[model samples]
Target: MMPDRSDLSAIAALLREVAGSIVMPRFGHIGPADLRTKSGPLDPVTVADEAAERALTEGLRALFPDVAVIGEESVAADPALLGAVAGPAPVFVIDPIDGTQNYAAGLPLFGLMIALVEGNQTIAGLIHDPLRDDTMLATRGAGAFLLRGAAARAEFLPLRVAAPAPLAQMIASVSWQYMAADEKSRVLARLDAIGQTPNLRCAAATYRAMASGHMHATVSRRTLPWDHAAGTLIVEEAGGHVRRPDGEAWRPADIDGGLIAAADRDTWHRLRDALYG
Candidate 1:
């Protein structure tokens, strides 16, 4: 069943609470860490990730008994298992720790991402910065908002893409994915036109930067549903566009590792034209 606007709001509140409980206990306590790699050397996961994911999974099941969930940890065990909840039916996509690297490094930029995919498209999203207890939320057709603290007032905000800015003055964010030699050279060449290329290691932070208009745009060569889901909507809700290099529309069920997001429509087109040519 499709959740109404009120339902999404309630879910966001629950998600925020879950993230706070699981993540706050270990904040600023960088002692006796328990971290491990997932796919490669730099792809790290910690106890906090698992604990937070478990909490989210359990809470969602309790709240929406009929809904399906696909979590980062579960997908890691059997990547093929993701198909079980990828589309059509109501599904909850989660990245318990969107910026695992930042979290491991003791940075407060890390966050929790939760997105509800209804039939292939993301209809609602909520991102929580557990360290700061800040929440960015959005529902399709409805506006987005930022909520601070437990009892803070919700600020209703509209997302509108800015007009085209000069490419030389634009700020672009890209990930250092393990690209092949040819891909690396091509990406660098594309970025050369922009004068200065900025790279941020964490997706959630990068998305936040772009949404807040500090960064003009952001693109990632490698991303899963959880990586882009919540942030993509937040950016779009904050007046941005999220798409692919070939001008292809992004679908939530896509796990083939391509993600592009920009602060405004024009910036997105500029980057797309530059990179694809």
Candidate 2:
């Protein structure tokens, strides 16, 4: 089931509130003891990530008592929690700080991402940027929109993907670090030859950039639900396309394989063949 309009607004507000009370206050004030190495030294997790996730999880549970919540920190503590996404219960997936590395270094590129998953499909999605005080939201069958500011006078901008552009004129953002080391060079060499590729190190911001019509496409091998669920719905609602490089629909339950999204199918196919073939 999709999140109601009022629920989306409330969740968006909840994200901002959590960030204000739990995330922003501890941004540049973290100490060595508050940080830890996760997957590797380059992958870091902070107290803020945990705090934000905890607060959001609890807040969401209170709002929708029957829904299950799967957060990044929660998954780290128990990988089994991912099973909830495919279960009968509606699951809310959360990524508290998508660009933890950027956030750790005092950059404001990080944001919070949440998606409502019913079985295998994403029914509703939201990506919130506390730094900018705006949110990109989409519910199934409903158009995506950008809500600017949190005040009563907030502005709503209807979102649409940019007009289709040729491969040579495309501006794509790719996350190369997620690719296999041996194949990264060849793939990137070809990507650089065709378009201007930039890595913002944050999926939420990258998706926002695409849905906002500032980018043509994005390629990524990391396909975690919390990371891509909200993004897929937002871009699709904006009239863009998303699928695996081999041409399969993206579902919240699948966690492997690469994804390529573009403003049009023509661009998606061209970019997919050029980069993956």
In model 1, what is the error at residue 65, expressed in angstroms? Answer: 1.1
TM-score of 1: 0.90
For 33-123, candidate 1 gives per-residue lDDT tens digits of: 5788888877888888898888888888888899888789988977885775455787898898887877777877788888888877888
How far out, in Å, is residue 87 in model 1?
A: 2.5
TM-score of 2: 0.96
Error of 2 at 77 (Å): 0.7
lDDT of 2 by residue, 1-277 (tens): 6677778888988998998898889888877888998778867899999989999999999999988899988898899998888776789999999899888888889899999999788999999987887899999899999977765766668999999888788999878777787668868778765568888989999999999999999988878899999998999999999998879998887787878889888889888888877
The pairs that clash in candidate 2 are none
Span of 10 residues, lowest total lDDT, candidate 2? 147-156
Number of clashes in model 2?
A: 0
Candidate 1 wrongly placed segments (more than 4 Å): 30-33, 149-153, 159-163
For model 1, the run of ten residues with the poorest summed lDDT: 151-160
